[model samples]
Target: MTTPHTVAPSERPHPWDRDAPHAHVDLDALRHNLALLRARTAPGVRLLAAVKADAYGHGLLPVARALAAAGAEAFGVATAAEALALRGAGVPGDVLAFGPVRAGIAELVAADVALTVAQPADLEAIAAAAAGARARVHVKVDTGMGRLGLAPAEARALIAAVDRSPLADLEGVWTHLASADEPDATEPDSATHRQVAAFAALLARLERDGLRPRWAHAANSAGTLLLPEVHHDLVRPGIALYGQPASAWLARRVPDLRPVMRVDAPVTFVKRVTAGTPISYGGTWCAPRDTVVATVRLGYADGYPRSLSSQAEAGHRGRRVPVVGRVCMDQLMLDLGPDGDAELGERVDLIGGGAPTAFELAADAGSFAYELLTRIGPRVVRRYPGT
Candidate 1:
């Protein structure tokens, strides 16, 4: 029943006057990815789409609504503020905050946001906050992640303490996977399998003690896609929902996945440069021969990586061209090569739409695909329903 048509268009002003760089988000592709993941996920395993870090920089509320309509039973954010924001925006369904809450407990509880009792002390504080109303809680058990969550031995007692309290509801229990994307999914001795085993044992102990949350989840996009055994009641998929692969291994597994966010800009200026013409800030790249150099209004300041100096490529006129200089704060130069018919105001894809993909560009910059998408500056306008 959920579809992209249910969401309203954003009223933010776009850079329509010139060749200003903009991020075009393909909502249809997002829905497609969601359907693909849902189709593969075990039946009865509800999906909780992770929309933290502004939905991995594709924009939060927009992505949340899209996924919710696409059949996500719940949504996950990294902070209480993110959960509150979703509630404020009127996003229905459960909004679980997976990270530590820095804000007041009353605000989150009143907002109906789920809290993670990672430690024993957190249980006492949350119980105190739930004086009049129930504070939905999710107990984090550190089966192996070593970062957050209480010890397995400490998890049950804490959950018991919270359950006895009149103001809290232990709604869901979950964990993070450290190596689900490494060495493929077949290695029996892999750290991911070990962590999964530990988690299973912990879950068994909890069940034996007659302790269970309404929802039990422990699989991210990588784990959900490869290991069906780990997809208990809910599978929270983050980057994969954005239509980008969470890892190279996942990319291979889900070959039909699409890229939803595309960075594009119009040709601001095109000039015929003579041989030996130095480009951009440092004279790092010079014209090997006389060619048409096009100035693109995209740079490191706009969330493009500067590490791609003289090594990046852009799409123009149905072919690829090289980024010929050190990318600047607001602009970069592209060597259009001879016989180029690029003109001013012509739309050129900088990172998608058949150009160097965000993953390929991020790889060239010695970074991850997450960085490339989330780092895109706010100055770059975003257009939805993009081709």
Candidate 2:
């Protein structure tokens, strides 16, 4: 006869289970980044934190709330829906939808969310949607970025049109920087410098014509960190606020910024493989000698780049281990030498958390940090350990 054994309450599986992967968001690091950015700008220059694309995949509402509490003067989003979501979540201060707003003009106007007027049609739609209510509008000018916004020559006519609309309140005028993150931004012939000059000339013309809006801004993360002259009235810092440098130049310039999110996944299986044994698909990697391999519960589908297959490394037991073989859709294998002792359900640091930072991982994948941060899929659980 054998006695039955019951699992203790503490040993039982958590609600998230043992194999769940998490993106641990450090709210303290986020707040610290915001303060560092604030310190870089001059007094009276408002900080507009870009919380678009679900706060760059760091959980929008929570990141926005943390930023709002950290003294961010305004929030810049890509769409009216994102702006409305922030308003619904009780995020105070200004919310500007800088992207194109083909629909939801009425809802945005009613919600008091500022809409960007990039063209004459956008101005017309916003004015019509205002009805009897006042609509706050920002005229976007194409300084150098030829994607959106009106040409500098065409901006005067649009500004005049906005001035004529009874329901439209011309609150701001802004432009996007094209090469502000490039190393040649300081050169006189560089695109960034030309754009800055062009925008300044436009703002001066508007001021002289008495058509200048209340706010005249043209600065992204790189611009905010590198070009103080371009920080006219506001600065929009996106990736930097999330604690990732916008580029190598910014990283070298601002070395104090800390990464706010760390990706972690649990090891689901551990096994010893014989020499010359192939791992994962296509036999891309084979063991040179007998070694231990650990399978982690994270993959390309969870926003880990497939290009990082056999190129990246993860942290295990305070040791750096090479990611072996091609990464599958739901799992990746790490080579832990013959003496390795990683067990089932052991945590592995995929990115950050004292391991390889997002910048390093992104470089290994031949991509940038912005793409990696935003590409994080919805399946990964976001955990705020110290909110």
Which candidate has the top score in lDDT? Answer: 2
Q: Model 1: which residue pairs collide?
A: 2-69
> By TM-score, how accurate is candidate 2?
0.95
lDDT of 2 by residue, 16-114 (tens): 755678888999999998988888899999999998888887878778888888899899999777888888777888999988697888888888899
Q: Give the clash count for each candidate.
A: 1, 0
Give the alpha carbon lDDT tens digit for every residue of 1-387 in model 1.
112112234434434625578788888999998998898787888999988887888878878878877788888998766777788788887888898674668888888888888887777777666658888988888878899987677787887877787777878778888878776455888888888888888788878877887788889888877888889889988888887787777778788878989988877889998999998887999999989999988889989899999888898878888888899998888998876767777778898886877877888899988899989877677677642
lDDT of 2 at 383: 75
